[model samples]
Target: MAHTPFKSVGMVGLGKMGGAMAKALVSQGTKVFAFDPNLKETSVEGVTLVSTLETLASEAGIIVIAVKPNLVEPVLAEFQKPAIFVSIAAGISYSQLVAKTPQGSTCVRVMPNLPLVANRGAMGYFCEDQAVAHVERLFYGLGDSFRVTKESLMDAVTGLSGSGPAYVLTFLQAMAEGGLQEGLSYEESLGLAMETIEGTLVYFRQLRRKDQNLHPMEVRNWVTSPGGTTIHGLDALERGGFSTAVRDAIRRATERSKELGKG
Candidate 1:
């Protein structure tokens, strides 16, 4: 009685992200057809691997472009059929992809980070109204999915969540270093860093169950007691302009993602 989405999905790259996504889809019991030019011939159990882009498009209703940003246009130009084209390239904008594909093409621009390999990644997608619902269904299993009303907001997503993992890892590294300085062994320091971050996220989840009236800054203030060790660390971070540095990093990454779309 209800209409279902793509029965078969196609992936145009067998690289890290693409390969992992295909694996995830197969694990979900969806049929996946994938392509990689470099490979002579290979198969991921449950996934059908093809050598050419045309074969990928022909087999699936949804064709995903997961190649490097620079390779997007050239790869799309090779597809002859009219399968819905979904671009997962970091900086390839929907407009750019549509222009490069055949006339009357349905295109969606999706940004998925590495955590998607584990199906816990956050994805941001923006597309024409015709493709939005379908794209949402396709990525429903990938992770948390959000639809961006305006294409321009994609750059902000790129800045925040696209590059967010690197910032998180940097924070973990710093925490581990701090633990080492505090007399913990190397492995023990890393374990503490990981556990501490995990606990922080769990605490935030619990806090969300409440009214959520307390902002992150309020929570920070609540923890940093006057003249305590936490305050000492906070003082060093404040003097070093840590928050400002993170803000600038996001700004630059957003700008770079925009530039990549143009290229």
Candidate 2:
């Protein structure tokens, strides 16, 4: 089924994720109407600021609720019209959104990470079949997106991609520290670490695009000789339980996500 594109988008919050998404939409030449009671100033251009949610809903075909999870209900209550509602509030489910919204309104729940600020975000979402295309269009240029079959898997997505950036940042810091210990200056070490990560990711992406069957371990093996520095480093990482720690972090985060949904 073909879905009509949103003529105008309304943004309910102007915080980090909201602001970034608004800017991205504006860049794509989409009309944007925004309303944020707490914000007095906005850095995004081409967005019309509205005084209330009712005003925004009246003008927009798609309404994006980017407020905190706790504020979602009250915000939805203020909507005077039915629109395609896309929410990025963590731990909030599609059923919860549907319950608060008007009957027959379309509701989609998305878990988007901080990288969205740079237009390289990773988003996971779930919605009714009728709403998938619209939701995909909404997030097109913001970053990569995943559509989950079951809403419950959104909790796993939250644990992995939603909280994954922080884990990567911590790993980057450790890599930089390791470089510093090897006598490199702080700035040089950090720069090198960042570039290495960025370049490796680009290469890995290209490889995966060419052959989806390729595994990450195969790429790691490509660089590690029979007896080389890479192998030594891998050994050290194994001894330090690096992989185990990462898995545990995601496991704990997934459990917390389930808990948050229950509340």
Candidate 3:
């Protein structure tokens, strides 16, 4: 069954990610509501602050469980009514959400990166049925979403898109520092690094539009000449274990996500 965009959404916690989603939803003109025990009054403009979890649950047709993984159960215990629950808590599985919520409720496990705050995020979600439509409705204003067939695959998403931004930022900073070694001012180095990345992304996007694979090696070879600066730079990166370090980072993060899901 097709579902129209929902007119309202609610959140349980107003922390960093939750607050960001709230702002996005509000910007889209959806009536937003939130409840956080720590907050004495409404801290976010255009969002109604409710006093109790039960009230938020009952009033919101689709309630986002934005609290931490440890807090999920206790919050679920407080809500006896059936409501579509979209959980952004890391490591909280679809089964856990279903088991915790009331019968007839829909559950969606979404892994959203930090950039959702800027409404330009890459999000992944898993659900058994059309319940994910509710997720799509709420996330319409936030960012693009990828749906995983199996819930367990969400861990891979966690390891990739979920943690990809931080990794990219680290590389960007390192690239800037590399320019600093060439006597470029910090500000100029950073600006050029950002533009280079952005331009490369644009080129890749154009290739994608034409159904071409982003063969990174093809692009690299295009830029490299015999005994060229690019080759020397590549050699330096390989010698520094950069490739291994990146692969290991993802591997370790995926393993940690699996452990977290087990909880």
Local distance difference test scores for all models: 0.84, 0.90, 0.86
Clashes of 1: 0
Residue clash pairs of candidate 3: none
Question: What is the TM-score of each predicted model, taking all chains together?
Answer: 0.93, 0.96, 0.94
lDDT digits (tens) for residues 67-93 of candidate 1: 899899999999776778999888887
Pick out the ten consecutive residues of candidate 1 with the lowest summed lDDT: 1-10
**What lDDT tens digits, residue by residue, belong to model 2 across residues 113-215?**
9999999999999998999889889998789999999999999999999999999999999999998999999899999999999999999999999999999
Looking at model 2, which ten-residue stretch has the lowest summed lDDT?
Answer: 1-10
Task: Please list the residue runs of candidate 1 whose C-alpha ends up more than 4 Å from where it truly belongs after superposition.
Answer: 1-5, 41-43
- What's model 1's lDDT at 36? 80
- How should the candidates be ordered by TM-score, best one leading? 2, 3, 1
Q: How well does model 3 score by local distance difference test?
A: 0.86
TM-score of 1: 0.93
Q: At residue 229, what lDDT does model 2 achieve?
A: 88
Q: Encode model 3's per-residue lDDT on 98-202: one tens digit a residue.
A: 999999988899999988988988999999677866777788867799999988788888888888888999999999998999999999999999999989988
Residue 45 deviation, candidate 2, in Å?
1.0
Provide the global lDDT of candidate 2 against the true structure: 0.90
